[model samples]
Target: MFKIKSLVFIFLVFYSTINYAQFTDVINSNRPGQSMAAFSVGKTVIQAELGINRIIEKDKDVDYKAAIWNSDLALRYGVFFEQFELIANLEYQNEKFTAPGVDIHEGALKKVLIGAKYLIYDPEKNYEKKPNLYSWKANHKFNWRQFIPAVGIYGGVNANLAKNKFLRGSDIPRDEDFTLKGMILTQNQFGRYTFLTNIILDKFPSQRNSIDYVLTMTRGFNDRVSGFLEIQGFNNEFYKDHFLRTGAAYLVRQNIQVDASVASNFQASPNIVFAGVGASWRFDANYNEVMLRVPKEEKNDGKSKKEKKDKEKKDKEKKKRKDAVENTEFK
Candidate 1:
């Protein structure tokens, strides 16, 4: 039954990619894509995504199946300065573990992540031009992405709240109850393609320390869609592993995107396959300032037009008042 389902899914994935060549995603919602965006979620913006993953392994001696349903909700709040953002995420997890003779189902809140990201540098021409204070509407044409990578730093803590439910039945190795992580993020864009890299260090007081590296390259077909390729590597005091993944994304609106992906072990378990589908939504808070600032060139152009319009309106108002006074005095 699982094999038949897997085959059907594979066909559908191939069909969709062949029909729709465009994709959409933001590093802020890290779903359907492996690379974290170097750009902050911006001031007063929230991002959320939901997806499910299934892993299947079949052998004559052992058969295994695992499924996980997840909800990832995140928000980035710009605080104090425009270059720094406060990040918070909640991941709700539910899983079912199946083996030769036993099936165990578990559901719980997986973990809550809180962190801060600071932009260290942005070399893009548009980013060099700051918008005037009164520009409340987002300027979509401005992008921090350039040939040189934009750099950022992140520090965060993950609080595990699984209640020891799935751990007892699962065979995968995971971090301790609480983990502290530090990451350096970099991203660059060439043409319509974006490349993002992350170097991470994980410290688990109760477990062995680990280090992870992730790289992702995304290609855009047009304004509304994109596709991505990813590579991930992990090293720890006791283990080393690698994986490769590919996926595509679609933007339903300015604030909503949907995605799907497939992955496999890069070294071992050639027959094992992992697949998932998910979507993300982002929206600006109803405030004076928000993410998506205007580009420098665009800002200047807009400023000139606005100033001219204001001058014209003021002159009209003054002439109207003067004319009214003159007519009344003569009468």
Candidate 2:
């Protein structure tokens, strides 16, 4: 059952990708080619994602099937002057097979992550000083700045709850698994360009471990647009395999982003190409307070006058009462 489901999911993903490509081309007619945008930050953001992939091959002597489907939803909140952040995610995955009626599945509250970043310097500030030379130079050199490098860690667990009463009740055994991930990122600017690096480690319930390294160069085209090219390599210890990915991102707007990449494998599955589009919106607004000064005499005049009049009236009444007491004693 699992085997059949996996094959179906993979086919769906492949079919969807093809259809999306055609639709995007028609919508992006004005653009030169398929271009991807950059990722951005938001104060409070929510995201939902769905993805699928499939591969199938058949022959007189051999037959194969594979499919995958993934769905995820996440929420993130920013804090500490918008420099630190926390996020939580829930994910579900389904993979089925057909040739042999086998099913394998898992789902979980995927992860909770916390991270921080600090901006050390901005080249745009210097551009104001040397506007002519900076504008003319194709490759501008920006001052170097570093964000205190930090790591984000996450851990979660999942369980299998599927019922296979059709088969012998004893055939289905309850299983649980754990997952962990850690990531570290840092960036520095030279002149108008920035260098970024990331290291990630992940452990899965299947006793598989993976580590990835990424390096990228980013150029700020203007106040609103930035472009980057990145190279990433991943090592899977459980499968004794490695893969590499190269990609780039362009910032189209403050809230819109797109990414495209190609991946190749070493000592594992064949190479495949993939692309992605992502967008983020931050509803942060700025405010300013203005103060006006008033004359001190006008401010204190009304309330003070009323208080003085009340005090004099109270004193007069007390004096009259004292005089009346003296008259009564004399009588």
Candidate 3:
């Protein structure tokens, strides 16, 4: 009887954890892409994504060409709740610029950002889509709920480090040492495809302020291989350009991934091109599972009324025997 009770308790814990937890069995990382995912890393999980890129640009208006080597790192940590995460991003660049009778070499920290993201809505929580057993057409039919994407919001601040090379020669003034950044993130999944969108606002209150957006579509070819295409646009008072990017990622392990990508813009005035390779690693040894309560209506495991009565009777008998044994020992 004790063993039976223990088994039932174990089953409940397992079932509840699987049904309610946001933590995945494998590491979820945002790498090889600029857009952020709507889901956070599971609670207590820490992850790092690192990348390096080579960029070349030519401006017909200014008659200047530049080559840049860039390195970036992003660190993410899930804390407080499963739906929340903290993030830090750092990027640095080394550049060589050449023009008619001019040449120079320079390096600087491009940007540093610290932020937090919280998931506002998750469509799968407390809702399960069950297949229709009677009609194959019904089961395969499109559902309106697929349009509801998981939503997350991000808020952060950018540290304007000194000697930033990109800040110079900009039309917009940047007098402040720190700037604000915010984004609305959304993601949707259908079978082997995933779509992600990021609406971003950066450099708040400064003349360099800009609104940017990233739209990404990814398809999984297999369990360990995936590819993605992205469109990123920058809309600012002084600068407006759109870039097309494509990338692929390969999972090295449950907690590691590597990726490569290339991007180019359409503008000839400052034709821009870049290519990058990156890797992500996760450390989740500190993670602990948090279970949620299942709805009472869904708790019924298809047991009939008679079966429930029989189980109750057996439970009562076991309790009585346990009480009797305790009483005899006391006497």
Judged by TM-score, which candidate is best? 3
The superposed Cα distance between candidate 3 and the true structure at residue 42, in angstroms, equals 1.1
Highest-scoring model, lDDT? 3
Q: Which of candidates 1 and 2 reaches a greater lDDT? A: 1
- What are the lDDT figures for the candidates, one per model? 0.60, 0.34, 0.75
- Across 93-119, the per-residue lDDT of candidate 1 in tens digits comes to 667778878798887776677888887
Q: State which candidate, 1 or 2, has the greater TM-score.
A: 1
Error of 3 at 92 (Å): 0.9
Tens-place lDDT digits, model 2, residues 48-153 = 2222323231222223233434333333343433223444444344443333464444333322222233322222222212234446563344523233222222
Candidate 1: residue 147 lDDT (0-100)? 59
When superposed on Cα atoms, how far off is each prediction in RMSD? Answer: 10.4, 17.9, 11.4
Assess the local accuracy of residue 122 in candidate 2 as a C-alpha lDDT between 0 and 100: 26
Model 1 misplacement above 4 A: 1-29, 57-65, 100-102, 125-147, 168-175, 269-272, 285-331
Task: Give candidate 2 misplaced runs (Cα > 4 Å).
Answer: 1-65, 71-74, 94-176, 190-193, 204-206, 218-228, 246-253, 258-262, 267-273, 285-331
Error of 1 at 118 (Å): 1.5
TM-score, each model?
0.66, 0.45, 0.83
lDDT of 3 by residue, 1-331 (tens): 0000000000000111245555766666677878888878878999888888888888878888888888888888999999999999888878788889978888877678899999898876767566667999999888788678989999999887844455436454654688999999988776667788999898786877889988888877876888888888888877788888888888889888888888888678788888888888889999887754243334676455788899999999999999999999999
